[model samples]
Target chain A: MNDTPHIQLKGVKKRFGSKLVLDGVDLTIRRGESVVIIGGSGTGKSVTLKCVLGILRADEGSIHVAGEDVTRASGSKRDAYLRKFGMLFQGGALFDSLSIWENVAFGLIQGRGLPRKQARETAIEKLAMVGLSADIANLSPAELSGGMQKRVGLARAIAANPEILFFDEPTTGLDPIMADVINKLIASTVRDLGVTAVSITHDMVSARRISSRIAMLYKGRIIWDGPTDSIDNSGNPYVDQFIRGSAEGPIRMEVRS
Target chain B: MSANENILSSNWNIFAAIGRVVLAFLAGTGRLAVFAGIAISHIVRPPIYWQLVLHQMLRIGYFSLPVVGLTAFFTGAVLCLQIYIGGNRYGAEAFVPQIVVLGITRELGPVIAGLMMAGRVSAAIAAEIGTMRVTEQIDALTTLATNPFKYLVVPRIVAAVVTLPILVAVADSIGVFGGYIVGTRSLGFNGAVYINNTMNFVTAGDVRSGLIKASVFGFIIALMGCYSGFHSKGGAQGVGAATTQAVVSASILILAANYLMTSFFFSE
Candidate 1:
């Protein structure tokens, strides 16, 4: 409800060897704002998310969440800070060794220190919310189909009811129908939770379905940012080229034979 | 004019090659040592996963029994045969049982079992963890408020250290029995005398030394496996490389550690 920035990245820079991934990335998201970052395959959209999460430290500048500098926290303070976030990795990233219910309940039991029985109950409830039945709870993650695994990943991410949620390519590697289904679930989940949501995805349809605002990351900087509905008339050539899905534009594709 | 320069450059190239190789080896060693230190620091921390430790013990120790038993048996049989042939030259064939028991307990039992585990348990560990790494399961753990080192690494190290000594103890018995079988059945010696000679010649000190070495070898095997898996990158190929590295490094460390421990125990 508060209109202050919940997360802010000021001149954040990240470099992997000589390849500069995020070059002076500056972005701000207000509390409870659902923002989707879109870019080409290697434009460092994921790097920006990771920087805010403090998974990958920014080489230059600072990242602050809820007015607290991310890098300043350590030990239990850092742990407490991380507890506020729930992430859905692009790969689903479920623990293969654990049962599906256990995977869903992982953050609850491990992060929040919820008892296993309580966590399992929460896990089953969350799975049902994602339209998965409770019987599949005992099955291994590998047993589930790709779409089912993504649902399970969503269930796991929201099971802890984190204050902030991150979806990394939520609909990637799915059939169009399954991707649409996942988009609906993610849309409802974000609205229901009322959490600040940050997503990295190239799927414009999914982005439009889930995000309140859209930001285009190009060559490491946010070249365009506006309301989700206003993306079409943004006037930025890169944004126009990206939305139109055209190859013949300023954004050159390096085609390697 | 350029011939002298070419020869000098070639000479410099040889030294550079050696320097690079040596530096790579040192860097690898340093990384393993740092990983071991981090693992050790977690051991004293709270939230020790005893169930995971028990599970690893079953995997690393119980499942390795068959291969270790078979290897120990063959090794002891060969030792008896070789000792008999060598002793015959010096007219000391009667001492075969004593030397066989001594050798099995003090040297071969721990080293052989350690090598077997290096191939079996170490490779399995690296493959499993390396796959987890590539899949983001490890990063997922970080997000879920679990320490990967505490949850994944410490249990394995503990399981190995606790279980390996027990395995070597089993190996020593099977190995000595193997020597007994060959000495009495094939080498034309009385069974009772063979058992008596083995029991009289082998001391508690000999078995103790082997057990200590087994514990050290266990530490090395688990450390190498965990180290390789934790740092693995890429995908399936990375996991494969990690598995190979784990086995090779664990095997080499086991042998090197065996020699060092043997000398330390017996140097006086």
Candidate 2:
């Protein structure tokens, strides 16, 4: 395998007014690698992902996708860059107006100009990949359970066969069993497609299962990064505290009585 | 602090507050202008969604028939009655048909239909798009490599600009019919004379002007709706605010544009 990084972010910074969200972050993911960013609820994990997608522009530094500077790409260049990405938002974010299959086929039809019939076939194929059947294709997204919706979201994410897939808190609202199912699906999809995957989640089980490598974000930067097998013995107090889910640690979460 | 200093500081504070509001308004106007420019630019680009445009036309134009029709009809009836009653004092009651037709075609028909559509269409557009925004569906479109403006705003704008004129034509005719019903039935005039007087007195310019105003009103209504919804944040409360703002802003703009267009059209 040629060892070029599929994505690289160096000294990336983002802020909303006076709130410093992403403070000089740096990370890299090699092609075909599945990397999960583990972080607490307000640690700018999503902001980092958004900056890479150009949904939210970074205030400083650089982001490169396949050796092309994407941080400042605008208009057609930005659109072309975005075409390579498929994001599964936290809430599924399925187009509620469209049926399940239509939602899956959306990027294919709208973005790629595929024929409706071919797009429908591709949608069904993707849905099947996530363990959903063809019977549910015509139903609206609201008709699905949380787990099923996540499956549908996964199907949609992989619909266009994007080279890079992003999952924003893929397992946040699911039951443990459902979260595990989604984690497996994500893992299988990434492996089967041989695509680069970056996911943000607070779920440790999901992180360990879906990712080849894991990075823990704290204080607007990646505090720990290593192979998933080494996470337990990484000896970083913050990562240890987070994975252990103990209240007593160097990290103090705000709580009010 | 001394009383003089206190008074001076208080005066400065008041001016500062007023200045802030003025600046905010100007800033908002500038943002709206830029958004409008972006929307217009996307409108001329290729890959137009004709099906979506037709869908919007059905929703905004075709479905609005009943409300716009009834409003125009009633306004014409009332104008006929009022003009006749008021004109009777000056022995000018015979001028009812001419005046009612003039009023309906030149002003009442388009304005009433525009305001009614603003109330109906603007709120619907804002609520739908605002919900989409809150749910991150618009963001999803961007990630999917689809331009939300091209998919959402352009179709609605074009549909409104096209449909509003057709709707105004229907309203103008119904309004004229309403005036005829009142003029001949209750006012006790020969139907033929009423029709002939209206036909002779009403110029094509009057109808054309009203249609022009309706098209402009349509553009305003859809643009405000799309703009407000596109910027909505937070959640249900935010969508609610956007809906209300769309209606209010569209209605005001329609009236203001009416004034401006009427002045330019009839300046001579």
Candidate 3:
């Protein structure tokens, strides 16, 4: 095993104006490991991921990816760092104006300067891997169903064979069967590609199925971190309260914001 | 908690509120200026997406022909009719053709076309980009190693800068033809004499200045649209606000810029 973790965050703190979203977040993921951060709504899981991606800067703390300090990097250095990451946004976030194939081929053609024709071919192949046919390639993303859009998003994320993949609530806004299919696809994709993944989700079933390890976030801190199998017996009230989906537990819902 | 103290604090709060509003407005202006600077800097760089620029040109310029042409024609006809009626009182009715050509070529053509496009193109841009922002497509582009400014803003800016002048030229030709129609038919002037009067009286400088105004107006329209859209937050309401801001600001800036350019070009 490598001495240094593939992705590391130490005391990552971020605040938007008066509200502190991420307060002293610390975590590490080994190479080829899948870590899913589980939390309730507005728990700052997305903020942590965005901080690592350099989309949002942490007010305090250091984020290192592949031994490079991503927080301070700028310009082409930052762009080079970003090239290693592939993200599946919660909503798929596919460009509505572009055809499905063009969305998948976007990174290759734009970032890698690949020829459009070659990129399109590669995109079709990726779509096939995600169980989509080439016939739907020319259709705009708006024409597809939510589940299909998610599949296209997955295809796009893995199209470039990136080193690190970030899935932001991959199963969000989907039915149970479709969500399971997506989870299986994600698990297989990550396993086959052997890429490091950090996902944020509230879906416990998804966390258990897609990740080797689970970290539960509460009040802007990681309350517990351990292997997925050990999660059931972790003996943490918050984790138990969250996993069981119980209303009467140590975790109290603040109804009035 | 005393009544006098409460009144004093309320007055102080009002002053603070005013100060905050002014400060926020200034800060927004400063941020927009910086954004404009960065966008202009990228204009000279490689990886210029000519295909996207061409598509935007077709969207912003080619599709705008009918509306711009119609507006210019009507405006020119009205200006000729009004000048003929008004100039008759001063026994200078023959000046209609010259002034109508000058008005269409120099001022009314560019300004009207600018305001029209500001309403049409700017709002659409702001709405589209705003929706993209809210949906995280902009962030998705970033993760793919694509700079949103280079991919989105640059192409639109280039297209506007290139196409607005062309649109203005089209409007100018149509506007002159409109004036010619009114002059020969309604005013009973000889068609050949009207054409000769227009050709001989309007200088090349007038057309050049109008085109210059159109280009600057183009830059303003696209810049506002992209700026508002990029900064948009929340959801559909934010997109709506961005669209309104884009059109309103672009129109105001176009008129203001026209004033500056007009004074610079035609001032004594």
Q: Evaluate model 2 with DockQ and give the value.
A: 0.87
Q: List ranges where model 2 is wrong by over 4 Å.
A: A254-257
Steric clash pairs (candidate 1) = none
Candidate 1 segments exceeding 4 Å error? A1-4, B2-20
lDDT of 3 by residue, A166-190 (tens): 9999999999999999999999999
What tens digits encode model 2's per-residue C-alpha lDDT throughout B1-268? Answer: 6999999999999999999999999997998899899989988888789999999999998889999899888888899999999999999999999999989999989999999999999999999999999888998999999989999999999999999999999999999999889888899989999999999999999999999999999899999999999989899999999999999999999999999998999999
Please name the candidate that would achieve the greatest lDDT relative to the true structure. 3
Better of 1 and 2 by DockQ: 2
Q: Which is the better candidate, 2 or 3, if ranked by DockQ?
A: 3
List model 3 lDDT by residue over B1-268, tens digit each: 6999999999999999999999999998999999999899888887788999999999999999999999999998999999999999999998988999899989999999999999999998999999999999999999999999999999999999889999999999899899889888989999999999999999999999999999999999999999999999999999999999999999999999999999999897
Per-model TM-score on C-alpha atoms:
0.95, 0.96, 0.96
Please write out the lDDT profile of model 2 over residues A120-146, one tens digit for every residue.
999999999999999999999999999
RMSD of 1: 1.9
- On a 0 to 1 DockQ scale, where is model 1? 0.78
**Model 3: CA > 4 A from native:** B1-7
> Which is better, 1 or 2, measured by lDDT?
2
Candidate 1 lDDT over residue span A96-195, tens digit each? 9999999999888777778999899999999999999999999999999999999999888888888889999999999999999999998888888889
Q: Using lDDT as the measure, what is the rank order of every candidate, best first?
A: 3, 2, 1
